[model samples]
Target: MIDLALNFAFVAVGLAQVLALVRLVRGPHVGDRILALDTMVINAIGLIVLVGVKWGTQMYFESAMIFAMLGFVSTVALARFVLRGDIIE
Candidate 1:
């Protein structure tokens, strides 16, 4: 039963990743695309966490944490660039 649940979660997250990629590609505006990219990052993080849970390992969780930090920083940088045309002084 647990394995079944994990498999279902993996499939759901994979589908979500594909849909987010579609949004990233077909978004009508730059901001929309950026948001879609962020969504994809979030979904990726969720997938990583699920893998960690499935495997009963610590490395996946650590990798997910690092990926999350990078995702957050990139999203903030992108939003700032869009708003101000510059990410740094």
Candidate 2:
């Protein structure tokens, strides 16, 4: 059933977020931490989409899109900062 599938997806995404948090905290390098942050962002988006599907709502999907865009920009900025030491040159 769709309800069962949705519940499973929610649990899976939550677990993924937790794992990503652990990586963020225990990462051996700054780059790894940045990657973990990106992974968390992705998991967050997944959770958002899942919520949208579970509720059959339109707003959550739009918010998820916005979050995805922001996540992409932030990830790029973080990676740039790691490589160049400054987000803006």
Best by TM-score: 1
lDDT against true structure, model 1: 0.93
Taken over the whole model, the C-alpha lDDT of each candidate is 0.93, 0.92
Worst 10 residues of 2 by lDDT: 57-66
Candidates in order: C-alpha RMSD to true structure: 0.8, 0.9
> After best superposition, candidate 2 residue 46: deviation in angstroms?
0.7
Residues 10-77, candidate 2: write the lDDT tens digits: 99999999999999999999989999999998899999999889888888988888888999999999
Candidate 2, residue 2: Cα displacement in angstroms equals 0.6
Write out the backbone clash pairs for model 1.
none
Candidate 2 matches the true fold with a TM-score of: 0.94
lDDT of candidate 2 vs native? Answer: 0.92
